[model samples]
Target: MRLKETEPEEIKLNMTAMIDIVFQLLVFFIMTFKVVAMEGDFNIRMPLASQNQEESMDEDFPTIIYVQLAAGTNGNINSIIVDDDTTFSDTDMYSKLTQLVESKIAAEGNPEDSKETEVEFDIARELKYSYTVKAIEAVSGKVVDGQIKKLIQKIKFKDSTSF
Candidate 1:
């Protein structure tokens, strides 16, 4: 007996289920999505050209104070030099620093004058971090009679390569 061969039928794919699954996934993601603010957004005001020019022409601008910290063999602060004139050792470093900073800005006679003054630190690369911090604290402020006295607000570090 001879067997008859049957032709193969075309397979049809149901797209409704696939479309539903895609729609479900899209809806889930949309429902779970959250809106967030961008980081580091700052509100800065730009000055006009005339104002900038006027400010630049002002001769009463404060001066820059240079403080150099030298390190010893043990990474400790060996000496503190201010403006190539005054030097304070580890024994009385902080007190002398505070006094020097106070005296420098004292001519202005206004506490706000300290804000106009800028301090640039030229610290040794090998100096101990603690000493660096202490030096910063010394010029930053002082506590007098149970009250905090604000000092120079503008502080910056000089490049180590320049030392």
Candidate 2:
């Protein structure tokens, strides 16, 4: 009697195609990654006027406060003098900022009638993140309800410069 014929083994799957598809998907993801930057900057386009109304007080304002930020040697912001002060530090900066805002609010009396307060940081071109962040933090703390904003009035350093 003839022996029963043995059935052939099923063909195995070829993982090469699967691997290629996976590689293609990986490459697609790498190429499609989004580039988002956190640094904020102000737009520099001044609107043109019809030249009818006369401009007044463009150069000097009496009620403006100047805050200067400088990178200290100790690296923890040792000196952050507001307007003019001999000695100051990061810890005292917030208190001073709060006091200033409080004084301004007190002087204004009515919250609605009070003029919008602006804080300026005359920062150096080579200023570091440590100094800038502290200034921002101080201003934020001083302004209740997060109204205090650090508007980028001037960027001293060029775009090429990295801080």
Candidate 3:
């Protein structure tokens, strides 16, 4: 007996939906991607290692402001000293340092130019990290109304062993 043969079914894959989804994903990622500014983009000026003898002897040397932090027995900040004369406790460091920096800026007669002043931080090795950050913020100054006011743009970190 002869049996009738049936035709084989054809199987096909639909790639249109997959291609559309892939394109959508690519568009979404492209739209959401962010370009970040690099650390060198701020145009920060670093101190030069050498200078002319005449320029070094000039009386208009950059005003150096010293911030010394003394650590207590427990590794906390015991006292804060500014220019070796003014002193502030841990709680009053912010206000006092801000006032001192503001006064220094005012004394310069040119608040717009922050290059004339230099800040040096003499931090102790045992001091807490938070204290060091607070000290830096104090010397950096803050915005007062709408304008951006800076005390000193040149900041130097001395050797911790010097403290």
Candidate 4:
């Protein structure tokens, strides 16, 4: 007896479900993505190390203002010190700092001469990043009524052992 010829069945994968799942995942990720605002947008001019230190020091050397941030045990700023002579609490930081910068500029004979001054933030390693930003903003100056007054344009950061 002769056996009947048999034909093989073709198996095919249904990719529609897989493609749909992939598209769903892409949409989920895209929808869940977050956009964060940038921190510290102030334009501060930093000193370059390539220039001759002696030459700059001779005549046009920028006046240095030291700002020290003392951190408390809770990681917040406990005290703010300017030039190591005056200390201010956090509540009065902005006003006092602005006053100090304004007074310094006034003493220079011309408010425009304040650009020749440099603010050095000698921050403690243990301090929080917020404190540093606060210190920078303090000396960055503010707008009064309608005029935009800039206190110091140049800024520097230094390491300090104490808080």
State which candidate has the highest TM-score.
4
Query: Per-residue alpha-carbon lDDT of model 4 for 53-79, expressed as tens digits?
Result: 544667766788888888888688888
Colliding residue pairs in candidate 2:
none
Index of the highest-lDDT prediction: 1
Residue 132 shift from truth in candidate 4, angstroms: 1.0
**Cα lDDT of all candidates, in order?**
0.81, 0.52, 0.76, 0.78
Root-mean-square deviation of Cα positions for candidate 3 versus the true structure, in angstroms:
8.5
- Put down candidate 2 lDDT per residue, 48-89, tens digits, no spaces: 333211232353332434566665564445455565652356
Candidate 1 per-residue lDDT, tens place, 69-142, comes to: 99999998899999999999869888899999999899768766687787889999999998987887788888
How far in Å is the alpha carbon of 135 misplaced in model 4? 1.1
**Per-residue accuracy of model 3 over 1-163 as CA lDDT, tens digit each:** 9999989889899999999999999999999999998652212444444443355577477788888888998789888888999998857877789888888888878877667787888888989887887777777767789865666676777742211
RMSD of each: 12.9, 8.4, 8.5, 8.4
Estimate TM-scores for all models.
0.60, 0.45, 0.62, 0.67
Quote the lDDT for 106 in model 4: 88
What's the number of clashes in each of the models?
0, 0, 0, 1
Clash pairs for candidate 1: none
Off by over 4 Å in 2: 1-23, 30-54, 58-62, 74-76, 85-87, 90-92, 113-115, 124-126, 140-163
Instruction: Quote the positional error of residue 140 for candidate 4 in Å.
Output: 0.9
lDDT of 3 at 138: 74
TM-score of 3: 0.62
